[model samples]
Target chain A: MKKIINDPFNFVDESMEGILAAHSNLLKAAEGNVRAIVRADAPAAHKVAVATGGGSGHLPVFLGYVGRGMADGCAVGNVFSSPTSSQMKQVTKAVDSGRGVLYIYGRYQGDMMNFDMAAEDCAEDGIEVQTVLVTDDVASAPREEWQKRRGVAGLFFAYKIAGAKAETGSDLSSVRTAAEKAVSNMRSMGVALGSCTLPTVGRPTFSVSDDEMEIGMGIHGEAGVQRCKLENADQIAATLVDYVAEDLPFCKGDEVAVLVNSLGGTPLEELYILYREINRLLTERGIQIYRPYVGRYACSMEMPGASLTLMKLDDELKELLDAPAETPFFVQN
Target chain B: MKKIINDPFNFVDESMEGILAAHSNLLKAAEGNVRAIVRADAPAAHKVAVATGGGSGHLPVFLGYVGRGMADGCAVGNVFSSPTSSQMKQVTKAVDSGRGVLYIYGRYQGDMMNFDMAAEDCAEDGIEVQTVLVTDDVASAPREEWQKRRGVAGLFFAYKIAGAKAETGSDLSSVRTAAEKAVSNMRSMGVALGSCTLPTVGRPTFSVSDDEMEIGMGIHGEAGVQRCKLENADQIAATLVDYVAEDLPFCKGDEVAVLVNSLGGTPLEELYILYREINRLLTERGIQIYRPYVGRYACSMEMPGASLTLMKLDDELKELLDAPAETPFFVQN
Candidate 1:
């Protein structure tokens, strides 16, 4: 109930204004739509324009990835809400480099409907636009119904691979193929021990007993698949690891890069603890780790949980992962 | 009192062991000193060696900086405790190429004494070593007694500049000078709204009322300069930003980098809120920002507070920041 903002309704917009001001040299505001964001150094010479959009809370994820070797542009919505079709169309035009634009976003209702409409709008304007829904979370649905699963942190892996191919000036078909490769090889599952409340909503999105943790909570405070008595770090890691392994069915000695991410409020101690167990589980199965990143990659606001993302890294994927990138949200080498 | 460690006494060691295992391809355990960590591909032909070390909790600061274009080696101590002199000596020996070693660490009594003794030990072993301490918090004393102020996140900025120079194979003296330059130009001030319980101690380092926050807190849950009633984000940012600006005597048209770091439990929303005020305050002074990083850079186990660091950068600092570097912890471009 207590905050210093001039208006709670304008929190996201005013915050973006400040962000653009600070990064004025590297970022710029899109014309017309307040929520539309594009790279200040846009139209990077004939490259396929890779654009992503989503709600705001999981930063650097949707917008932070808009930089060299990554997303070409981003459509940012209010916190936990999807951007309008008008905003999406603006991004489609802003990132267009005379080739095409690929609309990449998670599988959520509002995002799907608005982005779908935006695609039609772009076509009407003679701008070629293609869409790809990154639904890599295997916990939400069976493999046969993978398209219905919610997209989560694993979308980042797809973005990196696709963006690299796009930056190489690959045609839309090749870029799409690369993105699909990354997404198909990726799998993520999360467990929320607690929930996060949006800034405007002063109460938590979901709730569980202090001793019980839901095993498959969506990143946007969506209903979890199941809940059980709390378990130890090793047990939790084993649970998620087993699910991902069984779903993906990677053989022994397969190379993978692991991401053990905190949803928000979990401490580093807990992440490292989970990382320890995850490493043991994977190594015991003869998995070869290319690089292990155990930190908050994409976090829900104040949510107490962790997700495991395993991407089967190929040479191209490795190259993209190795690409040097910088943005307000994520910096990588 | 709940944690995920097997034994409280072995928490740091076990954590280090896990880190080594996860990073073994990039780092290794020093032969004689388990506390010292060296790059797996060390003694990089003739580059000057850069080594850093401090207590455990302020992660990604001392240990995470050990990679290409950063510290070549590091020594990690127990929670809020300094590594032994032997560990520092081992780190120096491991990193020492023919170009000598530069030692950079936060200002702490135990770390200072131990590193000094280690320098002497390295001297006996015919290895040259130089040292620089970051003590930039102004609230500990006025400018006349700046050295008495404890070091905090400001040290990381020093590390970036110094490490960049070291990566360019600068002489030990040049690297030391750049580090000192960064330290001299940097100023940081922090407040603590809560405390961090040491893993072994199993109790909070200090207590705070539900409506209070301590101003000018150091990294290791140390006492702050003043305890005051809790205020909104803008007021807190104003308090911190005013202190940092006044300490630096920054003027119009000055270009500086700002870091708003969360001390653990504070969410990104709060950090961003704090960041909004910081940029506003600096811009009002006609200052231009080169970079603004707001997140958990140096977290202290579940402690609730935010620290603001402002570094008036020179062309050289900006170039090094623009340089490409990669490590397990941070990647900069």
Candidate 2:
């Protein structure tokens, strides 16, 4: 494996150490728990605390979002593995204010189980905690089974709206409502040109022939709905956009916040190309784009692919989306 | 080659179209010249314009930096090729106010030739233009011959400082001096585990064994000073830091800004891990880090590697670095 890591076994720990060192001004390890990272000014009084956690490979996700206007804290885990409930509870306690905490994350089995358990643990300590699982990958399930779908890049929308609500001193239930609304109005799909290698595995998680592409692949290399000969950017964009837009039934005059996210190895230039096609198609369909973000917001480690996310926006959602946010990985004004 | 692109010959044009579509609020193609991109609010009266460009494929480098408090315009070129002098001249004219324009880019032969010709072209048109060629890759030349070195991630430092200076209404000479000083005090070196493929080429630019790495490789897959077995992140960090530090002869009390830039395929998590080691070694050497940035600030399309840049800063550079700036690819407050 051509990874620049000291020990594959310590990849998660070492990476967490590095994250803290580089972003010392913005983040800090939760007191007494290295696996839990919190904003340096966490536990602010009377504000609803927002927290998320998941596997470690996706930077700017779980940990990178913990800052002033985003998640107040995040529990971290090993590569593609969920953080322990203990870690989650510790993070919950670290960031919880008098208003309580809201837990948001992708709808993976391991993640759901851990966060659920942590919620129960926090309850015993009189710390109110609510959960909102993101289910926005349209290809992972039919419309009737949307709750079964996995979360993808659309989680960023959830983070933004929910974090913005919590930052406004909303209660835990209000924050949970905003997060659920964000997830309910979102859809995402991806096309993977190549596989990613987990540091621990020391090899690619999966493989694809040179001329093939996998559509709707999961962030952790989960099986996609289709595998076919590689296609050009326009075709790929059409496939992804059609699936996501149709799932949401986005219509003429509807506004959206578009995220053309890189899946690790895809360059921003390509993402913009995909975004161009997406914009053209959406415009043709008469859908209005309120805001468009193109970059690596979420990613698998070194996977060559891109994902498209469309979050149908309402006035409240738009206001929240446009609210100022500052984090190591993301900042907006 | 598994890249999400249309006809190879149309890659640059298509990507530029996408960029204009996604960032129309912040940027627009220059009138009468699609290959020249300018800020939507370009030609701000009496403000010295800052512009930079080179070969394509490096996102957020040339065009992505054109926005408020950064570059005012940038010339676009085909992948791994310099923009024509005509295109540069058009962009210079598009952004220049009464104060003048500053041209900054890497010291590649094609870039130098084209930019020099463009400067002359602008002179003939009575639009004052000054040039500051970035030479910061310590591995490309010895200290005595630093002017012959190639630019790398350190170019971002030059952009930030000079852009900030220009945004403050500095004159052409002042902006030029800030850019030159930034280039003079900066050093960078990279290690590539695999080569990046140009869209038009449709194949890897160069090849390396899975167990080996090339140190100090250029953005376009140019040869480095050494090729050896792949080393751990700490060892790689030490080698890169040692080379750049020794070249500057950075003193024990020097304060510097550090950038751990991903060469496309390397994930931010790995860059942070690399940054951790870099921080340790620099601190051990008594070099204090002022501002640290770790991300894909500069890239060679999907190449599996990273580069380290150190910009030794004085009070002026520090103030300029801290100035607020907002662009599609970068934002600071």
Candidate 3:
């Protein structure tokens, strides 16, 4: 209810308008569809195009990643709602080069359905399109049902690997393979200290007692595995890491990239504190951290929580992760 | 308080440990001084060193800027408290190359006094040191008493300009001049919807009615110029921009760099909506925005608010702003 917004009904459209205006130099609306955002210079000849899309609310996710070295375009949607198939098709067409286009996004029912429809449409037009669904939240499912897990911060790893492969002029199949590999090697889990409010609803999506925390909650306030008394940073880190590490079976001598992501409302100071405990636990297990990123890479709007993602890295994955990238919300050199 | 921290009294030390552990590749704690953080590859021969320090809780400030082509070092302090003179001297010594060091921080009494003492200490040790106090919060003082205003998010402009100048092998005096010029050209103001809580205090710093907002609130909950009914994003943006523009006397056709920074709890979606209106207002005034950066660049631990900073640019400042720099939290390439 305390949000600084104009009209709740027009939140998505108005937010996209603002984004396009502010990042005019780096992004533009698709020629015929304002819901689809593409890099200003898209369709680089003979290079595989990378595209992703999902609901609004998570900035730097679907749209913020559309840039020179990242996704070539993204289809945007209403808050907590997937973009329509038509919007996806428009973005796919806008960014597709002679090589093809790769579609990557979190594994949600609405998202999968819309993206599949768009892929079929693109195929009819002789534009090759492939899809990769990120399912890396270990707490969302058991190993036997890993494919049923929801994606979270681990999608960032998929984006980086796929974007790097496509930027190197790889074929569509190669980009898809890289993305799938990254997702398969990753695991994430989160604890929510508080809930986030939707602009339209003007109320929290869910609620918990002041002294309680929800473990394994989804980015959009999906019911988690358990709700328990609030614990300190070290305990929370241990619970998250224990679940994720066991799921991946990350063992001694394993090398990985660590992402300690805040869920919108958590401060960087607390994230770093959480990261400290995560680092200590990983070190005690003899796992090597190749590169650690601590910040709000992915988030739910105004949710007080944090997530930990570990992506087991091979030499190729490490190289791709270290490749130069520039975007409005993320930058690496 | 609903914070994920252990031992609130030791929050600063534990957070620093995590930061050092996470960014060990780019940074390291100064030898014999755990509170002093220096770039891993510090003391670049014959290059002016840029150092900054302030109270804790504001991540990405004070310490996050200490990396290649940004800041050479920083002195860490307790929550909302300035670093001691000994801490400042240790960091200055750790990063001082033959070219000397330039100290930059917010214009706060404790910070200024401690840094001045450190400067004298460095002088006796035969190390050249110059200081520039940032004062860009237009809401804190009248135009005739601008020097008394508190520094806020606008300090980031001073850091980027001075760091770029220092990286160019400029001497101490030249770097100091660039920093001073940047601070003079910048203006900022913020509105707070809620207050922030310190870990040790376990309570909000201040309070506001549910339907009220404090305009021009300081980063640390200092009283603002006005309190009124909370307005929509468009109206809020207009008030902030109008005040900042008039304070700078920014004329039509002027070029500037815009920073729409979050005070921790404001989501990017809301910030973008705010930015949308900011862009519209500036465009209507015929002001040319050179480049706009939007995110939580400087924050006050989970405070629900946003600040707008505009730095009028000259040819030199523009070039410096465009220069390449890399840090854990910020990167331009």
Q: Which stretches of candidate 3 lie over 4 Å from their true place?
A: none
How do the residues B56-127 of candidate 1 rate in per-residue lDDT, one tens digit apiece?
877777787788787889988888889999898889888888789998887878999999999999999999
Any residue pairs clashing in model 2, and if so which?
A: none
lDDT of 2 by residue, A1-333 (tens): 878888888888888888888888888888756689998888867799999999899887778888877888889999889999989988999998768898989999999998999999899999998889999898788898998899888878888898899889888898899999999999999999999888877888889999999999999999999999999999999998899888888999999999999999999888888988999999999999999999998899889999999999999999999999988899998
Q: TM-score (0 to 1) of chain B, per candidate?
A: 0.97, 0.98, 0.99
Q: Estimate each model's TM-score.
A: 0.93, 0.99, 0.99
Candidates ranked, most accurate by DockQ first = 2, 3, 1
- Candidate 2 segments exceeding 4 Å error: none
**Could you tell me the lDDT of residue B42 within candidate 3?**
83
Please provide, for model 3 over A1-333, each residue's C-alpha lDDT reduced to its tens digit, 9 standing for 90 to 100: 778789998788878887887888788888757699988888766799999999999876778888877788999989988999999999999898768899999999999999999999999999999889999887788898888899889888888899989888888998999999899899999999999899889888888888999999999888899999999999999998998899888999999999999998999999989999999999999999999999988889889999999999999999999998877677887
Predictions' DockQ, in order: 0.37, 0.82, 0.79
* Cα error of candidate 3 at position B126, Å: 1.0
Clashes within 3 Å, all models in order: 0, 0, 0
Candidate 3: lDDT of B128? 91
Per-residue CA lDDT of model 3 for B1-333, tens digit only, reads 788898898799989989989888888888856689998988767799998999998887878888877899999889888999999999999999878999999989999999999999999999999998899999899998888888999878888999999989888999999999999899999999999999999999889888999999988888999999999999999999998999987779999999999988999988889999999999999999999988887899999889999999999999999988888788888
| Chain A alone, TM-score per model | 0.95, 0.98, 0.98
Model 1 chain A weakest lDDT span, ten residues long: A1-10
List model 2's recovered fraction of native interface contacts, to 2 decimals. 0.71
A89 in model 2: Cα distance from truth in Å? 0.8
